[model samples]
Target chain A: TQLLEQSPQFLSIQEGENLTVYCNSSSVFSSLQWYRQEPGEGPVLLVTVVTGGEVKKLKRLTFQFGDARKDSSLHITAAQTGDTGLYLCAVPASGGSYIPTFGRGTSLIVHP
Target chain B: DAGITQSPRHKVTETGTPVTLRCHQTENHRYMYWYRQDPGHGLRLIHYSYGVKDTDKGEVSDGYSVSRSKTEDFLLTLESATSSQTSVYFCAISARDRVRNEQFFGPGTRLTVL
Candidate 1:
């Protein structure tokens, strides 16, 4: 099983503060995906990055894949209370299974 | 919100009792998966189905079983419940063969075994 490690297991910040979280792995990935999960709800797909050194933006959030395709980062600008949730990174399982292996995730809370 | 629905959103059962959870989708997706979410463990795949009557075990499939008789319905059954089985269960669907593409998840089912 391929394992993805997420940094900063927990984060609590004030509104309007900027923050960044990371996901890293030793295995090379063909593609990576990010998902945000709110309380009492299932996770929602935020974005998918396929190319190495690729960067994608979603309004206040920015996602970047490493040049080696073994790491990724998520930066949230001017965080708001609505941004409070668990952020997870996933990659396809090794051996071409296409099954996803998820990171433990980073739990963020933005206080108003 | 991909038309995925999990039945009995919340359930509480005693040990040794049999429990089953249902997942229904309207998207007609060809792939379905069952996962359990627990703290420190992330989301662990329990089972998945590629087509009707075709299924495979995931990372944690010991005490759980799944069956898909039709395109839209998938069922997960626990022959005997245990405290260790208590967790939030989620059902996901994908339009393509590879889960690396995109997946739509159900609201989730919180199961408690005491």
Candidate 2:
């Protein structure tokens, strides 16, 4: 079974601070997806990175896929209270699998 | 908000009791999925249906069962609820577009099995 490991399970920072969270796995993947989930709601897709060494930016958030396709990272610049939420990384399973496996996720708490 | 809604936004039941959750969608999407969200476990798929009367088990499908009799409704049932089964459940619909393959989720139902 392929697994996605996320680092810094919990983070608490003040507004205007920048932080980075990571997702790593030993298995290679064709694509990876990022999601942000707030309290009492389902996760919302942030971005999907397909190519190796690919990077995508959305407003103040920047997401990058590793060159080996075994890892991904999410960086938040000048975070605000609205940035407080659980950040998750998900990847499609290999061998024609339709199920997308997800990481444990990194919970961020940005205080204003 | 792809026209998806889950019934009984919050439910409380006792162990050994039967529980059923409903997912209704108006988007007419072919693929509908049920997942459970827990701390440190993220979203784990319980079951998914690609078409009417066609369903498949997910990574964690031991104590759960699902049925999709119509295109717009998917049902998840727990024959005998257990304390460990308490968690927030979410229903999602996907267009299955090979390119983006993004899933739109509903508000989710919080089930507490005491």
DockQ scores for all predicted structures: 0.63, 0.55
Q: Model 1 chain B — which ten-residue stretch has the worst lDDT?
A: B94-103
Candidate 2: list runs displaced more than 4 Å: none
lDDT of 1 by residue, A5-84 (tens): 99999999999999999999998988899999999889899998989999999999999999999999999999999999
Residue B98 miss distance in model 2 (angstroms): 3.5
TM-score of each: 0.96, 0.93
Residue B19 error, candidate 2, Å: 1.4
Top candidate (lDDT)? 1
DockQ of 1: 0.63
After aligning candidate 2 to the native by TM-score, how far in Å is the CA of A29 from where it should be?
Answer: 1.7
